[model samples]
Each structure stands twice: as C-alpha cells, then as structure tokens.
Target: MARLSHTSLWMFMVFLFSSYCTAKTVTYDFNVTWVTANPDGLKERKVIGVNNQWPLPVIEVNRGDQLVVNMHNGLGDKNASIHFHGMYQNGTNEMDGPVMVTQCPVPPGATFTYNFTVNQNGTYWYHCHADYCYPDGYRQALIVHDNKSYFADQYEEEFTVTVSDWYHELIEGIAPDFLSVYNPTGAEPIPQSFLFNDTLNSNLKVKPNTTYLIRLINIGAFVAQYFYIEGHNFTIVEVDGVYTEPTEAEILYIAIAQRYAILLTTKNTTDTNYPIVTIADSVLLDKIPSDLKLNQTNWLEYNAEAPHPQADITVEVASDLNPHDDMTLIPHDHMPLLPDPDYTITLTVNMENLDNGASYALLNNISYTPAKVPTIFSVLSSGSLATNSLVYGEFTHPLVLNHNDVVEVILNNNDGGSHPFHLHGHTFQLLDRAPSYGPTFYDYKDGSPVSYDAFNHTAFPQYPMRRDTFVLPPQGYFVIRFVADNPGVWMFHCHIDWHLSQGLGLLFIESPQQMQERLTIPQNHLDVCRVGGIPTEGNAAANSVDYLDLKGQNAQVGWLPAGFTSGGIVALVFSVVSAVMGVAFLVVYGLSDLKFKGKGGGVVEGSQGEGAGKEVGSTTVREAYRDNGDEVR
Candidate 1:
C-alpha cells in the first residue's frame, strides 16, 4: 500500500510540471500601411509600416506555441505578404509566403492570415516577400524562445540587434533604375547609409559581469555587413534558427536574411564602453558615394559616464577582413551527413541580358517567372498529375521530388559576384564548398570557374553543418543535400532582393501527391486571389481541363539575339540611317560643282576632287555600318 502511494505521488508531480509548461497561442492583428521615418538621419522617406508605426513590431513566441498573424493590407497602392523567414512550415505549406509561390499577395484592403505551429526555435525574422515590398521597411525580428536550449541557462538576458542597409528613396523609385536599360549592367542601387537596430548610434546598456544572449540578424534587402565588437569576443550558439555547438568568434560576415545568436559575457569592470562596428560590404556597390557612410558604430554601454569612442579602422576594405567560415560549424544535434543522394540536380548561375537588354540572373538557361496561379494552389488542384513538373510552367523551373527521398543540389557560379542562396521549407546539409573564406577566397574571381567534380572533389564531412541560407562563393561551387520530407511547393532563391527581381530562383515540387491528399488552402486565400484577378485552379496558365498543356503559361523575357539586344538593334538602325543621310548630302555637294559649271559654261578643276570626296564619304558610311554590325553581331 505504501509503494502504491509513492507511485501515485510521482505521477501527480509529472502531471503538474506538464500543465505548467503548456504552450499557448500567440496572435497578432497587423494593419500594414505606409509611414515616414528617417532611421539613418540622412533623409526621411516613405516606408511600409504595421499599425501606423514605422519600426514594425517584433514578434515573440515560445517554442511549441501556435502563431497566428492576421494581416490586413491597408496600403491602398501596394500589395503585401509576410514570410516567416527560416521557418520550416512542414505540413502547412500554404502559409509559407512568397507572393505567388504559396499564396496570392493580399490586395489592397484585403485580409489574410498566416497561422502555423511554432515547432522550431531560435533567432528568425518576418518580412514582406512580395516583389519590392520588404525593402521599404516591412521587416522585424521574430524570436522563438526555447527554454530547453543547451545554453539557455548560460545567459541572464537576451537582446536583438538588427543590421540593415538604408535607402533614401522608396523601392518603387529604385526599381526603375535597377530593372531598366538606363542602368545596363544591373548594378544594385547603393544604399544611403547603414543602420544598426533600425536607427543610428544607439547604445545598449549592459551590466558588468552579466551574460547576455545577443541575436544578430541582417534584415537588409541588398548589402551584407561585417560585424564585430571591440575588446570582446562571443560564443556563437545558433544560426538561421538552427542551434549549433557553441563556437567562439570575434568577427562574423552576416549576409541578408541570415541570423546568428551569440552569448556575450560582459567584462567585470564598468570603466568604459565598447564600440560595436558594422561595415557594409563595399564590393556590392557599383559606386560608393563619398557622403554615403558605409561604417556605422553602436555602443555596448558598461557605464553611462564612460566615453564611447569611435571604432578604430583596421582594414583597407571590407573584403580584406576575413570572417569565420560558417560551413565549418557543427550542429548541436550532430546530424551526420545524409547518405548518397537518391537524386542530384546541378545547375550554373549566369548573369546575362534578356531580350529586353536588362541584366537577369539565370539558373541554367531559364530565368524564374511567376505563374498565373500560386504554385501551392496548382499542386492542390492538379489531381493525380500534381507530381508533373510541367504543370508548374517552364519558366518557373520546376523540379519534382518523391516522398522521403534524399536530394542533392550542386550550384556553380559563373558570375563574379557572390550570392546568398536560400531554400524555403528545409534546412539543407551543406556538404562541400570550394574557395572558402580566407586569403584564397577570391582567387577564382577573374579566372575560370571551379565547378564541383562529384567524383574528384574533397570528401564530405562526417557531420556537415545545416542552414536554410548558405553563401555561394564567386566563380566557385557548393553542394548541399536535404530530404524531401515536406509535401508542398518550395522556392529556392537568392536572398538578395535585387537578384530575386532579376529571376535568380526556382521551384521544387516535393511529394505533390501527398500535398494533394493532405493540403486544404484557406478560403480567405482563395478570395484574395480572386480580388487580385489571379486564377487559383488548373496549371500555371490556368487550363483546368488539361494540366499538362501549358500553352498560355507565363514565360521569361526571350533571349537576346546572340550578342545583340533590342536596344542595340534600335541604336544600330538609327546610326545606319544617319550615316546614309550624311552620305547623300556629300553626294549632293559633289554634283554642285557640275551643275554650276554646266549653267555658267565654265570648267571647274575641283569637280573631280569633289567627286572623289563623295566616293570617300560613301565608303566611310558603308564601313561605319559594317563595323557596327560586326560589334553588334
């Protein structure tokens, strides 16, 4: 009888503990609109805001809680959608936002809700995923608190630091220059200033001898930044929502859409404060203006009375500062390298002019183009043909995957610029990359690209790192692997907003049959599509009768005629006409001498020379067109 009473007491204690830790639902109602704010103190411009406020609210939730964000697009002039970056939306793919990838963009005055279970925990962010929308300040940090973290007991408190690039003009004004022939090289617009936590020179008051967890996120649309703190080093514990084994680092290179969590223990003395420096990567700029400040300084205040000195300049350029290679970090779970992939997909990144003569990024030969129907809807409504990649449209670059198959992707860059590639719905195991961060990172910048030789390359690590976003070296290659366990359409794209605009992206239709069986999109999402005049049924072109027939599907801008763009063609035509007209004038002048000589009955010696001059002019005109033709062709 006594033993039975002890067992009942133990069971009662377990039940009380579980009841206390029960997860609750977190809900937020957002009214998205336009507001004005000057974060960098350089200029005030229109920025996207939530609830009539500019610095959008940071979303906070604990792991295992339910997150529901009821978003109403109050911006009468623009469309918007929120993408919870780095979240693996597992079975809820319809809520994975990317304009037309998962759901339609919420139209003006329309309401849409993103409701999902918070199963993962770490530092993350939520931002507008629609084209040219997030850059206008529709981003905020989304933190998922994990009481069960290995390092949770190490820190007394936590802080969120956001590094971003600020622009004086809105995305609408900047889009014309980036997507037009006037800026022929597709040079990304230079930001007016760099921002630290949505403002400038802000101080974080810290108590000496206290350990704090600092979450670093580059919430910018274009430029990445180098982050460091003077007189202190921190241990990195998490990256892109994945808890990694604690590693020590003094400097970190944070690209756009990337996040890192570090444990920073303050010094015992409160005699002085330290400067936290953020340097914009200058290599991304086409032209850095003299007045445009690239380096920004914030403070870690140990004492309010102590002077906060400016940071000491250490490097000649941002590239000279070598950051720790993130590919080497091991995950806390220590998930081993996935076995030889059941499938492999290989492609190259090329920056070339399309038929419009505007520069575009391409995977293989196709640039990502949107479809009339959201891809997730297509998968749900396509019946048994959902697994067919053809239904997703040619320019969407659809690749189908079977359920539970291990997939490998090889990405080779032919361009000289680096790209931070992000895959939605999964954290891929980064197996191998060439020309890693260090002195030899840029050795292939001007030379032939080093492609990943599957059979001849370095051996894969026993325990490879995993992250949703990974940086691809310029003119180098990277190989990653992941299991296609999720059943939905996921987009794999470059996180650089400009690159995505130029069509540097693709779609993966994973286990579409399962999606058709298990997925049911909300009716409100369908209503928004109707309001936007977007069809939600059938294939990409909206042919519900035949899923395989994609006749009217959206396609990318056609290829330029080998070395010649439409702009070049027009210029050539105008030059040719101008040359012909000039030749005609010379010929007319050459005959002037003969006409006068016949009328006056007087011989002119220069008539022969004038005739020769006409011949020379004719030859010059023909040669000019010929030379231009050669160059254009």
Candidate 2:
C-alpha cells in the first residue's frame, strides 16, 4: 500500500508540472490612431500609429505564451488590422489578420481582438495589413524569446534595429500616381530617405568587450537594403525567426520583411564610435529616381571616458554573398527529413497589362483579388473548398491540402525584377534555386525546358535552412517544401508592397475540414465585414471604377445593388444578437456579485455564474467565450 501511495504521489506531481508548463495568456491593449510626425526630420506627414506614438509598440513574449492584442481602431475614416508577421498562428487561422483572406479589416472606430499562441521563438514583427497603412507607420517589432535557443548564452544583451525606406509623400497620395495608366513604366515610387529605428542618425550605446545581439529587421516596402558596421563583423545566428549555424560576414543583405539576429562583440579597448551604414543595392535601383540618396548612416558608440574621434570610415560591401546558396544558412537544430511531397505546385510569376491598360502582377496568369467574403468564413459556411461563383476565380487560387501532407512549391519568376516571397503561417525548407543565367535561358529558348531533376537535391546540409521568406532572383526558379499541418487559409505572396498591391499573391487552403473543426472565429471579426463602405468582393470600394468583368460580358460586379446584400443583413443581425447577449451576461453577473456582497446576505461558494465553476484569472471574458467553442458562425 505504501508503494502504491508513492506511485500515485509521483503521478500527481507529474500532472501538476505538465499543466504548469502549458501556455499562459499575455494581453495588450492597442489604440490605433493617426499622428503627424517627421520620421526623417525633413518632412512632416500624416501617419497611422498605435497609441498616437510613432514607430508603434514592441511586443516581447516567451515561447508557449498566448498573445492577446485588443485593437481599438480610432483612425478616422481608415480601416486597419495588425498581422503578426512570421507567426504560425497554429489552429487559430481566424487571427492571421490578412485583410479579406483570414478576416476583414477592423472598421474605423471599432475594436477587434487577435489571439494566438506562440509555438516557436525568435525575432518577428507586426504590421498593418490595410493598404498603404504600414508604409505610413503602423508597424512594430515582435520578439519571442526562447530560453532554450542554441545561441541563447552567446550574447549578454539584445537590441532591436529596424531599417526602412522613408518616403516624404503620404502613401495615400502616391497610390493614385503609381496606379495611373499614364505611368506605363511601372516604376515604383522611390523613397526619399532611409531610417534606422525611425531616425536618420540613431545612436547605439555599447559596452566594450561585451557581446551583444542585435536583431536586424528590414521593414521597408520596396527595395532591399545592405547593412554593414565599420570595423566589425557579424555572426549571423538567426534568420527569419529560425536559428541557423553561425556564419560571419562584414555585411548582410536584408530583403523586405526579412530579419536576422547577429552577434556583435565590442572592441576590447577601443573607445571609438563605429559607423553603421545602410545602402540600397544597385541592382534594385533601376527604377528608383537617380537623384534620391541611397545611403544612410548611424553610430554605434562604445562607453568610454575620452571623447571618440570624428572620422568617416569606408567598408567594402558584401557583394559576394549569394542568396541562392543554401550552404550559407545551415539549420542549428536537427530537422526531420521531409517525406515525398503529396502535391507539387508550379507557379509562374509574370506581369501583363490588362485590357484597361493597367499593369498587374500575375501568378499562373491570374491576378489575385481579395475575396468579397473572408475565405475562412466561406469555407466554414459552405462546408466546401470548391471555387464557387461567390468565391470569384481571380480572388482565390485554392490549393486544397490534407492534414500532414507535404507540399512542394516551384516559384518560376518570369519578371525582370527580384521578388522577396513570403509565405504566411508556415516556414518552408529551401531546397534549391536555378538562376536564369546564359546557358539556362539559352536551353529554354531553344525548346529544351530546363529540368529540375538534373539539380543535386541532396547538396544541402544535414539540417537545411528553413525560413519563411526568400529572395526569388529575377527570371529565376526556386524550390521550397513545407508540410501542410496548419489548417485554414494562408497567403503566399511577394513582400514588395507595390507588387502585392498589383495582385502578386495566391492562397493555400490547407485542410479545410480540419479548420472547420478547430477554428471558432469571434463575433467581432465577423462584424468587421458588416461595416459600412467596406467591400466584400474585390480590392476596390463598392462603386470604384477599378472593378472589371473579365468574362467580357460587361456585367456588373455584384448581383445586388451596393449595400443591399442578404449576407450583409444576416451578419448585422447576428452581430446585434451577440452584443445583446454579452451585455445581458455582464449585467447579470454584476448584479449577482452585488447580492453576494450585501450586508444581510451570505456568499455562496458555487454561485459565481454559469460556466464559472473554475477560477478565472488573466483570461478575458471574450477569450473565455472562445475557449468554450462559442463560434460566431
């Protein structure tokens, strides 16, 4: 009997420890509003910001923690949504936050809550998904710390460094000119300046002889930037939220939305301040205006008593770094070998001028348009993944995948410009790349297609590099593979802001049946679509002239007159009912608490409320509702 008692005690302790290791909730309240600021101290412009502060806010959390952000959109007349870039958002696809794909934009003067658990740890960021909003200022760093990281002990302190292309004109003002038919060259609006952490001449204080980890994030919209610090070398430890084998370099090339964590050791006894430089790559400068400055500088000062000398330093750019080489970024951890793919998707990316004379980026000859209804909503409501009349052809390219199925994607870039492709909700293995050089192009033009079978697929290291974003060289082909384990709708697209706006994107619908079972979208998310003046179909407004009837029949875009759809009415009614029920519950709970605390009454131990038998702590009421599987559909 004593032995059995000891066994029970051990089992009980194990259960308690396991439960404690589960995720806990971390909540943040964000007020999205407009602010006027000069990020470069040269031009004052109206910008969208969180809490009326420029550069927004940084979110830091440990791995296995639930992140809950309550966003109150106060941007007068503008809609907004925050997308947690590089987050897997496993099983919580409703909170993925790509407008019109996962959920609609949070309407102005409205509140929407995003909740998802962090399963992996590294550097990441959050940005506004609304068109041109992020470029204006709605972006911030999101860092997830991993105590068990391979390089955790290598650095004593950490800092976040953000580099972006700065524009003097408001993105709203530039959009019309950029999309105008008269501008047939498709030249992207060039940035006037560059910003390091929202400033031109930022300073980084460092301790001599100490090792510091700097998380470098390229949040620019258009061009790729090359970063280097004079008199120092970087040991790259992480890339795009995935840890990699340490590789040393004097300069690093960071594409749009890509991140790198590098270890920088201060000079042992030097009191000198080092210059940190950022310059736009010459290859990407073909479309940029010739007069715009391409380089920006900051200072990294080491703590010392004597004043440092004021001298400029010139360093060689890391032009020899090849993005196509997979050997450069070996994974630090052991990665399980991917099984033979169940599906192979070949996507050809190109640009073509439509009949209306507007240039659009296309994937597989189809320009992507945002769906009228959220793809997740459509999947759950219709109980199918088929491309129906409601889900327009150009709006969605559905690659329906089963759970745990391996998917290989071959991205064939036919355009003359490089594109940094980003895949939402998953990190893929980089298998190989074939550049469109002389011999490769010559064979293809001679009616001999370049075969991928000739490429050595096993040349990658034992644990290959896994990242969410990679640069697809102009007129090149890239191969990537990922397991379709995360359910719901995901977007695979170019990170170039202008190209993405021009419809360079596609959708992957992974395990819709599983998504229907796991996802419970909140009522507030559904209510965003019911807001006035928001388009449920296509990327344009209700009466916008940009809508095209591609079938050549000259038919109208929507069946009903604007704002008279039955679906909108049903959504409004449902939102109203949800609001009423929530209010009633709160009132009843408040009254019951008052009764319990009255002078003549005795408190009842079990009389809290319905579904309140267990103790509630940091979890909010809405989160509790979601936990109970109270879906809005």
Candidate 3:
C-alpha cells in the first residue's frame, strides 16, 4: 500500500466513526395508494404492496433484525394511515399507526417511516387505519419467524392465505346511523365482495403429499369468514401467530382480527384441477325480509315482537354427514377465563328515538350525539370529519380489564337489522344467546307463547359454539367470553358498514401496567378519544330542527311524531299542563263559592228561612247564625 497522507488518514477515520456512531434501530415504510382503476369505477380506493402485491409481500426477518417501513400517502385525495393490528412496538408512538390519532394522514406524496426491532415471532397484519366499515385499502401481512433455533421444519414449502371482504363504497366521512335505514331493498352505500390476496381465484400449486405451512389471515373490513378447501382438511396449529394445540378444521371459519397457521397437504400430484380455493358467501343464515312486518293485524306494537318473521337457509356441508361421521369436530374448548369477571356490562345494539324525528341505532339505548368539548369549534363536529347529519354518539363502550381478567360481553342485537360484531386483539368463544321471547318476556298473562312462526320454534336452543366471532341473528342475543390477556386498547364494534360509520363501536383497556407499557398517550387512539372522551350522542347538532327552547319560559309541548320518545321533554310538558289545570280548578271553585255566599244575604234560620239551611256555600256558618239569631234578637 502507498504511504497514507495525514488528510487521507483523517478522512478514513471520519468515515469509520460515522458508520459506527449510531444507536441500534430500524425503519419501516408503507403507503396507502388507490388501485389506479377497478373493473367498476369506484373512487379513492386503497391497495397494498412493496412492489404492488396485495399483502405488500411479507417483511421476513430473524430475531434481532432492525425493521424500518416508510408509509407513503398515494391515495388520490382520500386520507389514510396504517394500523399494525397486533404489534408490541416499544418507544414508537408516531409509528403506532393510528390514523389521525398517533400520526396525521400521510398527505399525498409524503412519507413516514416506522422503525422497530424484531422482538417477537407471530403472524400479524396491517391495514387502513380507518374503521372496519372501510374496505381493505393499502393493507398487508407482516410475518416474523423465529430464529433458526425456534424455526419449525422448513425443508418443504411455505404459503400465505389472506381472507378478507371487499366493499364497493368510499367509507370516509360516512354517517354512523346509516344502518338504521338498512332495508334489504334500500340502496347500499357500500357494495361488498370477498377477496383473497386482493384478487379472486388466487392459487398456489405445489407438489402433492408435501406439507405446506399456510398462514391464513382475515383483513376484511368486518365480519368473521369461513375458509374451506373443496377437498382437503387442515390442521390449525397456530392462532394470532402463537402456537396452540393442533386442532382439525373440517371447515375453517376465521373470526375478524384473527390469524391461523395450518399445515395443508394436497391429496394428489396428478390432479390438475386442485382447488386453489373457492369463497363461500358469509351472509347470515337468517336474513331480514324486505316485507318484514312492523305491526300486527291487531296493530299492537310489542317490543318483544321479532322485527321479521323467520326464514331458513339450507346449511350445506362439503359431504353428506354419515350417521356415524363425528360432528364433534366443532371443538368445545373452555376458554382460559381468569377469576370471575371483574365488572359486567350489558349493552344492547338497539334503536331509540333520535333528535331528527327518527328512530336511530343505539348501544345500551344511547344513540350517537356529539360530546361537549372545548377544542371543537364547530357545531356539526362529531368526529374529525364532523358533519351536520352525523350523530355524535356511536355505540361503543369503554371496558377495563386486568391482564389476567376474563371478559364476558353479551352483544344483544335488539335492532331489527342484523350485524357482525368484531373484537380487536383476541378471538373469543361464543357462550350462548338468550332465547327468543314472544313480544315480551312476561307479556303473556295467559302464558301462551306469542305466535309469528309458532310451528318452527325451539323454546331456547343450546348453541354454545367455540368461535372467535359470530353473526347477530335479527332480534337475537349473542353472549361471548374471552380472556383479557392482550394488554392494549381493544375495540369492540359492529362490522355492518353503515352502522360502524354511524358510531357503533367502543374501546376497552386491559391492565394499567400493560396499557402504560403499550399505548404511550393517556388517551385512546380512536375517533371518540380526540375530543375529551365524551359520548358522541350528546351532541347538539343531532337535536331535531323543530326543537323549541324551553330552558327559561314554561311551555307545554305535546303530540310527539312517530318514532320519537322524549322522557324529559314529555315530563316537562306534562308538568306545565298539570300545573295550569290545577290553577284553573282552584279559580272555578272560588268563583262558585263567592256567588253562593252573595245570594245568602248574611241571614239564616231553618227550612223557613233559607230552605232549612241546606246551603250550598257556608252551610256551617249559616246554621250557627240561625241558632244564635233567637238569642241575639
């Protein structure tokens, strides 16, 4: 080597120092971009990919690998962000990936990078930060495998399966109460379809008899999905990225926010027509009819009356069940519940009178109203995308749980419409549904069950299915229980497109320590938390246009329109009217007494004087005067 010059030596030293002078870190990047164009021209769509693949091809790394992803905003005009559904990222708030909560929308052509270390192994997903009512725009799967020591047999092959639903509508700034008007015939704001890996008929073919690790994920906007191979059965060995006891799925029904790893073995190598896959419709077996009756022939409006009479669908399985075929394939594993539930909350998905002179959906009977927040400068403000038409309160609740606490949430859909309820972070076991009561639970004095479809009914069906999610049959109640083992903010919400937009959601926190460890901000990262955490239903904009100001002056108001109930307003009107009537009675009685007294002329005796003192007014005084008159005269 040539002799080094002093200047060259210093420059070399500087380069060395610069290369080694950094803290241990990594950066992650992503972008929310539209699909350029679809077969049908829907606007402002979201698509995902590192090079434009649906799941933005997996970011594979071993333990201790530094990670960095820079999220870019490429959606034409729609605002979007990314949420890593289940990631324990430490020391990274901005990268936490909540839209408008942790970070602002990656404005068109802007980029924000997320940096973290590969701390754990599991199958997780990231999607649009907007509510589940939105379609899977700019979403993908992120899988971190264990280092060599923890890796399972990988000599064969690896595959990924993503199951999700697609919507044909733009979800931004949609009102939450849209579900209330969900008549089957009514025009849907969002048309929905199912997609696998962002396309239909996505196939992965390989050698027969070879074991392939299939990672199945559901990134649907809402609702759990059932994925089945036309021919082969799968062994579900992992859930939410964690290895669990291997269970067999004759048919695979995956819940929202859930992931599963299955070992798929194709039967024959020579078979050219292998089922890459086929999607089954996830619609509820019980659908609401267009002509569902609201009133009976007798016209008695009963609260317990089912919104629609029952209709049935054929529950088809792949093969005819031999009498000896074990239907016991549906596992009955008791969830690992902690001690008794810490606190019990009963919330009903229902409809109550709204300020707009219409009946609206409710969570625990409270509809969406705006909260009283000072930072909010506008009256139409309900969420960040505040509007005059939107209700303030969406039907979401706040629950607190310990890391070890067990939670039993009973989602009773009393509304006439059906909904798919989804929980974040954990897959829950469905416990039971309260039996369908006729009209009222105890309305029958004669004790005859009310008759809509009297013939095809069970007093109460014992349906305790082990599922992470289930459909809410119309006019039905679904009780579910899950362990609060995950330690971050979790959201429970209706997957119905319009209902979620209207505000049908709530959040719960588990373990103060875990909460503090995971979420850096004291406030929750949802639309409800930004404005001081008040119930949205209390907003003034949601009040009716015809509402009168009775704050100061006493006024009697009456004859509320159909679909309206004002307990406080009714009480106020009744109080004012009742007081006026009381005063009128006193005045009339006083006037009559005065006339009777005037006619008497202050003299009294017996019947000879004033008809035997059978006086209408002052009878006692007249009798006293008559008896004393003799003595005084």
Global lDDT of each candidate: 0.88, 0.73, 0.47
Model 2, span 337-453: residue lDDT tens: 587689988888876655443456888877777665566666665444222333333446556777889999988777767788999999999877665322232223223233344
Instruction: Write model 1 residue lDDT over 17-88, tens digit each, in one string.
Output: 774577788999999989999998778889999999989999999988899999999999998999999889
Model 1: lDDT equals 0.88
Off by over 4 Å in 2: 1-24, 287-291, 303-327, 384-392, 436-461, 532-633
lDDT of 3 by residue, 290-340 (tens): 432211111011122223222121245211111111112233333343344
RMSD of each: 7.8, 20.9, 21.6
What pairs collide in candidate 2? 372-536, 372-537
CA displacement after TM-score superposition, residue 56 of candidate 2 (Å): 0.6
List TM-scores for all candidates, in order: 0.88, 0.78, 0.56
Model 3 RMSD to the real structure?
21.6
True-structure lDDT of candidate 2: 0.73
> Where is the poorest 10-residue window by lDDT in model 1?
624-633
lDDT (Cα) of model 3: 0.47
The model with the greater lDDT, 1 or 2, is 1
Clashes of each: 0, 2, 38
Ranking by lDDT: 1, 2, 3
